[model samples]
Target chain A: MSDFTRDEIHRLALLARLEFTDEQADAFAQQLTQILHYVETLNGLDTTGVEPTSHALALHSVMRDDEPRPSLSNAEALANAPEQEAGCFRVPPIIQEL
Target chain B: MTDAPAYATLKELQRSLEAGECSSRELTQALLDRIEALDGKLGAFLRVTPDEALQQADAADAARRQGRRSPLLGIPLGLKDILCTRGVATTCASRILRDFIPPYDATAVARLRQAGAVFLGKLNMDEFAMGSSCEFSAWQPTRNPWDPTRIPGGSSGGSAAAVAAGFCPATLGTDTGGSIRQPAALCGVVGLKPTYGRVSRYGLIAFASSLDQIGPFARTVEDCALLLNAIAAQDPLDSTSAPVATSDYTECLGREIRGLRVGLPREYFIDGMEPAVEAAVRRAVADLAAQGAEIVEISLPHTEYAVAVYYICATAEASSNLARYDGAHYGYRAAGTRNIIEMYSRSRTEGFGEEVKRRIMLGTYVLSAGFYDAYYSKALKVRTLITRDFAEAFRQVDVIATPTTPGVAFRIGEKLDDPLQMYLSDIFTISANLAGIPGLSLPCGFTAEGLPIGLQLLAPAFEEARLLQVAHAYEQSHDWWRRRPELA
Candidate 1:
């Protein structure tokens, strides 16, 4: 039996910073429960003492000399901004007045 | 379109250009006209750039006039929309970045440009490369050229469809988990997903960073090799780019495969696969065997766990990569929001499609405080086991062969409502990405209904030369590469 629930779905959406309608959330909850049920098959395998492989290559932290180079100008970087003011991206206010 | 030669391979196109039979401008113009006439029903291209293409074609012609000849010079190609192109709208078929215009070309795109390949325009894909069928695209879904009622397997559906429809000689595609191979299989074209880090990924829009790699789709094994030769190079811009040297992949086209050993994994030839698909792939392997190639039965024991492992790892990376789209940066922003949090949440909810949201939420759940070790960490350990399976199998065989998909192309809406079934579409192709090996898909045979079946050839990591050699041998011995979809 799957442990997924509607409350857990809502909690996940909140953590993901997504807003879903009640109807959408209901549908998603059902679908996700089914998918989770299918993926639970992985738990059947015995994988003791196995080292996790996060990347295909074995390269460590790659670094270059600390030097300035040409990059996108402010105008080019902000070219696709939905809203901009004073060469900066503009967003809704983070704080609210009481 | 009448002036365009009917040569099916990019190598033939190169020969024609070198011989001055037709100028690059003429070939580019005819293809542009064909796209204008046929693309409405196919829905392959989201945008077409005639002016830029003509300008590049003219320059290629001028370069040829100076007696310089290169394999990809003066060839017109389509780019999957996920690859950023300067001054072109590089939407990954998502409404969120529908208006986003990149300021620079992706490393692979820049390499193709330097190699003198003319760009037609941006192609469509599944939203954020998240779906198996192209139906999740914000634009109209790309229909298979072989049958308009069926899907061209995605998220590289548009790339495969455009090439199959003859809109261009070839195109670039990205595959994380069978996006390139599955679509190419369904559309009856050739697709190659090189070893991870074989091609640079600097400007490709992030989906699953660890799994995504750019590749090519073309009509013939040789054309795929030509395109791979141009774009497979190391770039400092991409930290994950492999430092290994690039080789002329075309040079191995006619290599003898008489002494080669091919492996057939017992796990892949199990029940539930379509009868016709299995028969076609078996016949192809038999054809190679008759040519003196040896076949060995092998076991990739952890194959059953690929889907679970892929979804966990891909979604986890996707959730982290996509956190940058918070409505404050470039892309869509929700209007009439009272606070920043509301702005971010509402914008994403309205901007992303259903599939993207599902994966995002699933990723969040797995990586949550209590579930990390149970889900994400466990998946990583299982992933190592899967990789080891491939390593052990490669020791006994030079290449592994399997059916690219379990069956032929399903109808457009066949699996839309079932996410689990859709993920299963990539069952045969995901292990390559997980193990970071190279894989190729080309037409082996077709069903009685005329839909194509693909035979996949996978090689050890960085052994693309061996993979292409075997594929080219099989392709030359068969007539499947000569057939094209009769699009009206």
Candidate 2:
């Protein structure tokens, strides 16, 4: 079984974008190990020649015609925006000067 | 003239409305009154639009007077806040969208309204439907009606609790992993996650597009079937919705289960399962067998991988879907950001919960350039195997039966310290989502501690009619639904 080390756990948390305490990291490492152990049982199954199914029901070409249809107007769309200006959603600048 | 019509199912309420025994306005007011009395403790509703509900109800009553009758006419139910309700708050139990009222109704919500179903309000859920327990909601956690100190299983926790508490006849809930079934199991209600594509998801806030399915939580299997009839149809708005023919789910109720094959997967009866829960499941199976249903042991060997595979696949999809949540769109925005990129980062950081953020990160990692094949692709391969496991098992038996949850409801905060432990609560239910099969959880027995236990029955995709029939048959043979939570 692959052991999830503190570094690996930290990497996962980082990827998840969660700022976790050291204690939480350690705790999660132990917990994730147990979960992984249970999940590892999947290794025993032989999936030879089995077609990998993406959805339960098979669907082919699930697309609609490219006809322009009536949709919520921009006014209705931006009406719920917490901040809006010039018919577009307004947000603070992303680049930090600090 | 009688008091509140508590314990009435949706069909019963509809009959009353059509017979003019009660009007939609009266029923809506009754539900609002119940919510006012019980929601102080249950915390099920995220928003209560009494005036809007009454207005719709009055219109429904007028329609019935004109001889227009839909099965759900005038029935009051809650929409999971995750479903967009036009001109109504659909916060999805997250701070990011707390103040956002959608300008468009979800296809499911719009259809429910067209069916003459009255909306009681939007129910609470795990923030972005990420958590197993309702504890992740930005709002207060919804309490289990059976025991206020315990959690109402989530991310459909509020939907389950509201039905269990009789605040509404039924409620709509979206299930990605085990959100619908787990909570329904824990809350002792009938919760069914129909085969994927059975219902449309045009306006449901996307979690995992492929895995997410909207279904019903009700007090009985019959009620669930009725709700499904009203909601399950091929929707032009939802490209992924099934184009198959729909069935009237209640038609097979009370039918003989005699000589029916029921498979008990050995993989599901693993170690660490609570003995009481196992006993309850066995007892229910024995009862079915005594009723002439054939009980056979089967193996879904790949079932063990569901949680890992689900986490990988669902998170990957969520990471992609939620990428659109940048402040440029509706939802929360961070102040003092210098550019669009930083705005997206800060807004997401502040908008999502710890669990959601964790999954998003995991999703990002798995979908990242280097790890996509190793994690995401491999998970999809394993998911295919999981579905095949059910497929092969179903060939041996008509339906698969198991304990809905590994154990009865755990006390709130019991596993909050260990997120992994909390994740395991969905272990038994996740495989169903992985396979995109129709699965139902209904009250079967009670633990020695007096808490309810549920039995899960699963069928191949698009077999909701059979699944509901099996559940309804069992419900008829048992009196578990007659018991109510001792909450005052």
Candidate 3:
């Protein structure tokens, strides 16, 4: 991969749902490039036939009874909601009105 | 009880409470008072709920009077802020979730509560457990008790500091990438990270699901074992929690370590590592060899690639986990946004710290359509090699010994400027997390500058008992843990 350019960082900030200042974007371009450059040290090894390990443990699917159980109460679930209204999380309109 | 400063190992305190020399209420109040006086200088606690702690303490005392007993009964302990406590604010030291409270307890906290542990309240960490130092904490940076100008090694810096400062006998700290051990090493306490899935992560605000494990920081190895006994168990709530049977962790204490093979990896002794830290770890290895254990020089050939793998995996996981914090559902929300997308962007940019944004963006970049194969996928292949290296070494060794950190704790602002340097500093401790094995850090020695050096011990999966046993043996022969900062 090439060095991280500021425009690429800007695009990434949007993809990640974050907005960075011009200074932060530029700084990130440099810092992220450095971090990725160091991360490139892994390229020295030949892992041609090696399987990629996503999890170290050999985890199997867990099963449970299909019995009904009490989950969190509605009020409890909404307790930390930053914008709750009418027993639901209220949010700004996704579609702007003309 | 003797008229001493509030520094009693959990076992000693348990014996005192059992003997009826002092009531739980009195002991809890004394520790609260000590925290009141001392914790101002060391910001180990994010919140100190004396009233709630007293109520719990009274209940424990009543249970004791009624003939109830457990090892953790009436013992005051701190929780790392990352663990959710019912009605107690559980921020993972992030500004985004500063006002967040859980409606239920984390399984680990619940187990400890059932074992009659009193909550001394939450400890601080790096914002979302991201940074190497607690300086990334949204609230306050936890200062080292040994030298106030230096940082307490983090992201469980507060948990380590609280135990080392005698604010509490022990505290639970989560280690995804040496959060527990590095700080425990710097703060001069014993810290343990059990094998992945050994403890339930149901209510731990997840940083990385596959890597995070809740463990302990304590003044003694025995206290850590007692704590592990109370909390280490499978849970129906956390699917990732292994159904493997747990044993009495304390059973292995005081057991002879004769003929045990301990591996010393040459890669851990790098060129730029602090000489004192290396010396301390070598001295510990020599001490173990003197006690009839065979010391072998082993090769974990892929050791150099640990930090690279960890950053790729951990950041990728973190970016996904943190996606739930958009303005609509919970956590901080931005005001005056024209539409939802802008709201999400504004809320996240404002709510997150620089390190967090860097990681999220970096993670996004790696997982993006063009870069996955080059970065994330490549890192996973290297991860296999790292795990294989440990698996190969453990075949001939019972435990592996290494320095917990490359150096002693740095001055608070020293490495904060360079993100890459901060990430590289975790080189010694990140491998254990990557390999899903057990690792522990105990005070081995001190430097001329009076900073504590940590000696880390690694064991194969589910071999926490071995690490505790070996650490206990080393701890018994030395007085390193006996020394504390002159807090008075």
Candidate 4:
């Protein structure tokens, strides 16, 4: 059986950085429990010694030469900011004062 | 201009424009007027850019006068809202990016612009391309053009509806686990999800980076190929883009399918499928056989696990990709937050829809410390087995054929409350995305209730040319493409 409890879902929401109301969490927990149960069928497969396919293409470390090219200007980059100050994105205080 | 059938294919419009029967501006105006009349009922388009479209049309007309001709020149098309348009709002049908207008165009959109295609507007979709039905859209649910009470499949619901309702001749849609094909199937149009990396995903809002691919929706197979020719290209900006030569997809449309090998996957024709859908697909197979194509029975045993694997992989990627939407740089920011943590959490809570949140949570759970190996890694390993299943099957068959969807379009809100049931809607189409193969869905038949049924044709990776050829042969032999929904 899937073990998706409300508290587990709350922990996941915290990790995901999204706030969910109790009602939302409760409903999602139930649905997610059902989904987890459904996906648990994969455990029945004998995937021993099988390699994981992260991407369809097998290319590794696709890197271009270290060359600078045109990119979004500072004004354009800051254009979509909800709050901007001194030509930089303004955010809530990260380091709290003692 | 009024005499022109609004449901005319893109090729028909091209012919008319070339023959001087009507100017591009006149066609654009007529289509814009039609959208004004019909889209209110269909909810297919989130916005309509008449002024910009008309200006583009006028420029196309002048270029035509200067003896410059292109297949998509002066053609008006809608874009699934996920693609960023330079100065246009690129809402992925979510409240978060409700007013997020990008400063750049998606590479596909820019290529189409260069090919002279005119933009009608951004179309509706499942919020963040998360739902199979369009009902999850933050704006309004897009109704299927065939039947108003039914959903036009999604997250490309608006693109399919627009093509079906004749709001535009063609449109672009992204498929990550069947968004393009399912909707196209339901609406009786053609939708193609090219091989992953076949089309650049430079500016497409990520939904599942490995699986997401931008493709086209049109009334006919030929039109789909034409749109593909214009948009399929290698882009330096998208590192995953295959640096291979692009083909003129239209060149293969008229090719005969004689001596072609089509595989019927037994796993797809299982219980719970709508009888009408199965019957239509079986009939299509027979039709291809009659056209001198060989039919072979095949097995893709891992087909049942596609939904499970898809959910785990897609949600994991989506959880990571969507981390940028924390009310920091762009998109909607919630008010009344005490600290940065509260600000990030509250903004996402307010911005995303229930389905998006559900997937995000699921993704987080699978990728978490204790469950990572059990869920996410297991899913990735199963993904390899699934891909191997296709690779083995394709060695003996040129293309695999199946019913695009389990059933015809369901009524709005019919399956909304059941999330598991909703995920099963993409069972057949997900494997193609997972395996990185080209898949196309085209109208094959209609049910007794007059709902359209789709026949899916999937080709090996990068074998879109062969896939389109076989689909075109079947399409040319049928009268289904001639049928248009009577949208009152």
The candidate 2 chain A region of ten consecutive residues with least summed lDDT is A12-21
* DockQ, candidate 4, vs. native dimer: 0.84
Which residue pairs collide, candidate 1?
A: none
Once superposed on the true structure, which residue ranges of model 1 sit more than 4 Å away at CA? B3-7
**Please, what is the TM-score per model?**
0.99, 0.94, 0.99, 0.99
User: Tens-digit lDDT track for model 2 on B1-488?
Assistant: 22357678877887787678888898788878888887898898988999899999989888888889788888888989999998898899998897888888898899888888889898989999998889999988999999999999999999999988888889999999889999999999999999999999899999999899999999998899888888899988888998889988889888888989999999889899989899989988998898899999999987768888887788889988887777677888878777766677678778877777666766776687776766677777898888878889989999999999998888999988676678778889999988889999999988777788989999988989888878887888889997888767
Error (Å) of candidate 2 at residue B109 is 0.9
Report the poorest 10 consecutive residues by lDDT, candidate 2 chain B: B1-10
Question: Least accurate stretch of 10 residues (summed lDDT) in model 1 chain A?
Answer: A1-10
Q: CA lDDT, every prediction?
A: 0.91, 0.85, 0.91, 0.93
TM-score of model 4 vs. true structure: 0.99
| Reference contacts preserved by each model | 0.81, 0.53, 0.85, 0.78
- TM-score (0 to 1) of chain B, per candidate? 0.99, 0.98, 0.99, 0.99
Question: What order do candidates take by DockQ, descending?
Answer: 3, 1, 4, 2
For model 3, what is the alpha-carbon lDDT of residue B440? 97
Stretches off by above 4 angstroms in model 2 are: A1-51, A92-98, B1-3
lDDT tens digits by residue: candidate 3, B1-488: 32252678999999999999988889888888988888899899999999989999999999998999999999999999999999888888888887988899999999999999999899999998988889999999999999999999889999999988888899999999999999999999999999999999999998888899999999999999999999999999999898889999999999989999999999999999988988999999999998889999999999988998999999998899889889787788988988899889999988999888888888888788978988899999999999999999999999999999999989999999899888887889999999999999999999998899999999999999999999999999999989989775
Error of 4 at B208 (Å): 0.5
State which docking tier applies to candidate 4: high
Go through the candidates in order and give each one's DockQ.
0.85, 0.46, 0.86, 0.84
